[model samples]
Target chain A: TQLLEQSPQFLSIQEGENLTVYCNSSSVFSSLQWYRQEPGEGPVLLVTVVTGGEVKKLKRLTFQFGDARKDSSLHITAAQPGDTGLYLCAGPFNFGNEKLTFGTGTRLTIIP
Target chain B: GAGVSQTPSNKVTEKGKYVELRCDPISGHTALYWYRQSLGQGPEFLIYFQGTGAADDSGLPNDRFFAVRPEGSVSTLKIQRTERGDSAVYLCASSLSLAGATQYFGPGTRLTVL
Candidate 1:
């Protein structure tokens, strides 16, 4: 089974602090996606990284894909209370199947 | 709707009762997906539909769960003889196409099987 294990299952940090969440897997994926979900709401896509060693930034958030495509990371700079939410990483089984295997998830809380 | 929409934001039913969750995808979107999310966990894929046909249903846990998208725009998920373990949020998502496209998610339907 292709499983994505996320580290630091829960995080609580003060505003302006920096934090990083990791997603690792034993199986290689063709692409990786990050999502943020609020309480009582479905997850919303944050970013998708396809190439190995590629990095993408969205405002204060930075995402990186490992060289082997078996892992990924999300780093938040100067975190704010608004950045608190559950972060998940997902990737497809291969090129043909559209189904996604999701990470265990990281619950982040930015205390103001 | 501008984005995916789900009905009956919350449902509470006794165990052994049947339940149905609905999902309306964005207009012109041909791919629809269903996922189940339990407390403190990420959403798990349950089914995926490409148009009116289910391209993949391998993620479904058991035969008691079934879904259909007859017209290719809306879909319904039915659970038979529901158990307490079925309590969770059922999420719906849609994309313009199945390949290499971003998915937009609905608010989700929270089902509590008592």
Candidate 2:
């Protein structure tokens, strides 16, 4: 089984602070996706990075995929309370299949 | 368009009992998937269906876990002899088709086994 390890399992920071979370895996994936999940709700898709070394930004949130396709990162600039949630990285081992292997996850709490 | 929808937002059942969770995919999505999320962990894939047939069931933990998508739009996940370890949030996702397609998720059903 392919495994994705996320560092800093939990983070609590004051609002407006910048933070970055990493997702690493020994196995390479065809693509990677970032999702944010709130309490009592399913995960909401944030971004999908299909190319290695690709960088995408959504407002103050920036996502980067490693050149090797085995890792990725999410950086939040000037975090807000609305950003407090569980951040997850997921991908399928094969491009033809839809089953995703998810990362352990990073729980971020922004104190407003 | 309406996103995926699940029924029985919360379920509390005794150990060794049976339970069923239902999911209604988007209006025309043909691919439905089931996943289980535990405390402090990300959602784990459980099953995947393409059309009315199960394309993959490798992620299912055991034979007790079974899922079916009879009509290709709505699906159900059934658990037999549920164990305490089965307590978790069951998530359902749907996509227009497989092959790296984007999936939309439903608010999951929280199942608690006592």
Candidate lDDT values, in order: 0.94, 0.95
What clash count goes with each model?
Answer: 0, 0
Question: What range of 10 consecutive residues in model 1 chain B has the weakest lDDT sum?
Answer: B95-104
* Candidate 2 local lDDT, A1-112, one digit each (tens): 6899998899999999999999999999999999999999999999999999999999999999999999999999999999999999999988887899899999999999
Native-referenced DockQ of model 2: 0.91
Per TM-score, the best of the predicted structures is 2
TM-score of chain B of 2: 0.97
Give the Å shift of residue A3 in candidate 1: 0.7
DockQ of each candidate's interface versus the true one?
0.82, 0.91
User: Cα deviation in Å at residue B54, candidate 2?
Assistant: 0.1
Global CA lDDT of candidate 2, please? 0.95
Clashing pairs in 1: none
Candidate 1 TM-score over all chains jointly: 0.98
Clashes in model 2: which pairs?
none
Q: By DockQ, who's the top model here? A: 2
Give a tens-digit lDDT track for model 1, residues A1-112. 7789999899999999999999999999999999999997888999999999999999999999999999999999999999999999999969767788899999999999
**Model 2 misplacement above 4 A:** none
Q: Write the per-residue lDDT of candidate 1 for residues B35-55, one digit (tens) a residue.
A: 999998888999999999999
